[model samples]
Target: MRFLVITLIVHRPDPVTGITPSARDRLREVVDSAVLAEELGFDGFGVGERHERPFISSSPPVVLSHLAARTSRIRLFTAVTTLSLLDPVRAYEDYATLDNLSDGRLELIIGKGNGTAQRELFNVTPEDQWDRNAESYELFRQIWRQDTITAQPRYRPALHEAEVWPRPYQQPIRVWHGSATSRESVDLAARYGDPLFSANVTNPIEPYAELVHYYRQRWAEYGHDPALAAVGAGTAGFHVAPRSQDAVAAYAPVFAGQLAFQRSMGMEPVFPTLEDFIERSSALIGSPQQIIDKVHRYHEQFGHSVLHLHAEAGGLPPAEHRASLELFQSEVAPALRRTIPDPPWPWAPVLPEAAVTAAAD
Candidate 1:
């Protein structure tokens, strides 16, 4: 299985210690984590976008551009770029520039995004967000494929064979649709034969598994190859130690912090207690063997070849968090990598000889 480390750049005070890093420090941590992920040999590192309070990931392109400069070979990803709230033309321009800056190592995961504050901030409503997402993606894909395209869209001004500057470095970059119990996103992903990435952090396996199955079903209906349908899944959290008890004990405060943060936000959590959270949620907190077993269980349901772990050092101490990640690479990853089949990585384009000559001339 291919593994990615992702962070949403949540800027909240530590629930356990009542300490919050300065915004600058918080962002520095994210950059540092991406570097660490590369050092630890992760396949990719992703940053999420959220235009709301407590989340400073409003500009993933800027953040990813920096990450691209810091590391080579590790694929850079947007955990879920908020297409519904963005102008497709602008979005494509930023990512295209980033793709060039990253040496064509950029991949995208697009979603409508959530949260009332962010939706309000972007002037996107639940009723029309899906339509906006679909429309934006249609235009965005056209921009990526064609040199110039004429088009009209409801959410943005019409394009009359408009050519966006700094053409893509990659002929076509891979885009994964991010879904969370949303058939609109799933159907869109299947219709286009793009990969589906399940936001599996919230609830149990049943909902996510059902969505994955439906994505596969739709993939067949759309005349796409069943073998080409790729899926990736996200985890609620990640912490591992030599012993299950030790891992659980260390993660308990983190769990408590999560519940506190939820309640503080006036949202009730599905798992009120740490034990329930571990029992049902996708959080990987246990010994290495137990973590591997849990992943196998999840893989049986989702058939996802890609898995993402949280990159930030949430409530855990920096030393322990680093140790857990190191241990995972040393132990858990090898075992899972041996058994789980991975989806094909995105193709990096090679310029034609004619194009190379034209550029030189």
Candidate 2:
């Protein structure tokens, strides 16, 4: 595993402390976290897009563009851009612009977003979301590959001989389809020969493993190389401490509080009880050795090259949150890297270190 630190930019009262950071503070924290991730030798940093309450990351491109100006080596990603809700033409233009701004270090993981509130916000029904995602992705891919094209879709107008400017630095920028227990998402990724990213945060291993297996099967059916099947997985949470006991003692209450809040809001947590949560959920809240073992088990199931962790959640305090990241980078992440290979397309164009150093000055 190539480790990625992902954040939802969650803005809510901490179930433990009842404190939330200000919007200004949150923005500063995001920039600080990106910089720290690069310094800590993390391969990627991603921001999630959520249009509903308790989430502030509505504009991932804007946030990523800012981080691009500040970091040189860390790859930037969108955890999952809701392709079903946005116009493909607009997304293509903006991401292509971001590609240039970041010196070509951009990877998109597209998905039909979760949360009923988000669907209502975009006036998209659950039944129609998948179709929208398929249509939008088809147009988005075409927009990147073709210079001028005509597209006629129900959601968007026809573009006759239309051209989008400032093409991306990488010809056909890398994209991964984010799949969450949806065969449609898996099939779409397979048909396109793109990578599949499993949302393993909210479910048991069997469902996600089946989807990954399905993705590989479909890849072969689509005449793609089975050996080249690329898959990524997301972890629920991460924390590291000197000892397993110390780690659990500190995190268990926080975890339970967060779960209770989710339950109170009518959401179903994958793990109901605190004990089951620690044992079953993908959350890696323990010592470095424990975390490494857990990741190894998951690797056997998913065969994922990329593994992402949501280290901060439920409005944890900045000091506590940063400490967890510090410990993880110092102790756990390096071990995982030794086990998994780098991204297949590591040679993708990106800004040079000298350019970023000079820009900072």
Return the top candidate by lDDT.
1
Candidate 1 on 1-361: residue-level lDDT in tens? 8899999999999878989899999999999999999999899999999998899999999999999999987999998999999999999999999998997889999999999999998888889999999999999999998999999789899999799978988777889999997799999999999999999999999999999999999999999989999999999989999999999999988888889899988998998888888889999999999999999999999999999999978989988999999999999999999999889654333443555688799
- Quick one: how many clashes does candidate 1 have? 0
| Count of backbone collisions in candidate 2 | 0
- Model 2 Cα lDDT, one tens digit per residue, 260-291: 78988888876877678768878888888898
Each candidate's root-mean-square deviation in Å? Answer: 2.3, 3.7
What's the true lDDT of residue 244 in model 1? 94
The collision pairs in model 1 are none
Q: For model 2, what is the alpha-carbon lDDT of residue 10? A: 83
Deviation of model 1 at 334, angstroms: 0.8
Candidate 1 residue-wise lDDT at 323:
95
* Residue-pair clashes per candidate: 0, 0
